[model samples]
Target: MRYHTVIAWAAAAGLLAGAAGRGYLAPLLPPDEGHGAWYASRAAGISAYLFLWLSLAGGLLMSSAWFDGLVNRARLLAAHQAFAIAGLALGLVHALVLIPDGWTDFGPADLFIPFASYYERADAALGTIALYLFAIVTFSFWFRGAIGPATWRWVHRASFVAYLAALWHGIRIGTDTGALPVAVLYLLTSSLLIGALTVRLVYVRPRRQAPARPPSRAAAEPAG
Candidate 1:
């Protein structure tokens, strides 16, 4: 759960950077009048930022799968689902905002498919895939009982895919891609997540052999 906390905090920071301050509060910065063509790129940046934040928060909540506490797990999963929906919603906002201009500018094809589209198509494509994956996994939880444990588990595994894509989406398009702060944050959070899982994999494994106690001559003599 400590790991989860890390994910949540990181995600919150990312979201606020792109959504809370970047998008809504475009305060005193000089306007980029020359880069008028980069509107789609800007929108993609906002979406990717928000998506990473939501995914981080969701990931923190998801680390509860290892918990033995039922109520706690449920609470965390609920939070995870909620943030994922927020990510999806923001992604749609990103897409919709582009619609009015994308068609006339780059033709309709670039908006849906990736790589072949406009400048920001990569991030947009990743966001779209992550959104669909989030929807499937989130919705499947409601039918958990009907699907039974195995199938439900498989469905939920899609969460990781969504998370990875969302993270990649953000890193690939963020204006701060090369910034020291962003790089430090990304490396620190990623290392923390991977490190914790590694510790569990190595140090937390079940004991396979009894500790070797020296064969004491005294104990052997006493037994005789």
Candidate 2:
């Protein structure tokens, strides 16, 4: 089977599973009783962040020679792509599940459009923007051939911006950001990604120029 086909199926499966889970839990834990949608959104948001982190980390590893012998590049690339797709899927679920939450009053425009939400508009916008950026970067994989390698690389760099936006969004607006464990998770993951990127930048060797062919004996003897 083709790689793109697998990615499409995986994304579809993820969305279906998320929708089913939300449907099952929504009735049992009503908004008045426990705010199930809110909880689900938080969980999905955190999971998506973690998946994005993994995808970025894997991409850094793929570009750097540090893991060349230790890890299989092909597998690393596959994992990176898979994680990115999973992250995008979970991100959509994170936002979509919130539609049922009565507390926030998040309409489709508020959830999908940046700065459209009245509640914590700036912070929520960051998350919304991050989601869109993630989508662009993830889908760019499918169009890499058409866009050309240079453009594809530049598009992939948008992941860094997406990561930053997500981190900021979570820290500023996340309900559980105050918790020690969640704070620690955010700190640790961001630190690891920064470290990996540093290694990639510092250790990535430039292409070596071909050595100039030594001058022939005749040329050396009588240069003209």
Measured by TM-score, the strongest candidate is: 2
109-149: candidate 2 lDDT, tens digit per residue: 98998989988999999999999998899889879889999
Q: What is the lDDT of residue 49 in candidate 1?
A: 42
Q: Which ten residues in a row have the lowest lDDT in candidate 2?
A: 24-33
lDDT of 1 by residue, 14-45 (tens): 46546654666455233756543345445544
Structure candidate 1, residue pairs in collision = none
TM-score of 1: 0.58
Evaluated against the true structure, the overall lDDT of model 1 is 0.58
lDDT of 2 at 40: 84
lDDT of 2 at 88: 84
Give the poorly placed runs of model 1, Cα more than 4 Å off: 1-19, 22-74, 102-109, 114-124, 174-176, 180-185, 195-224
Per-residue lDDT of 136 in model 1: 84
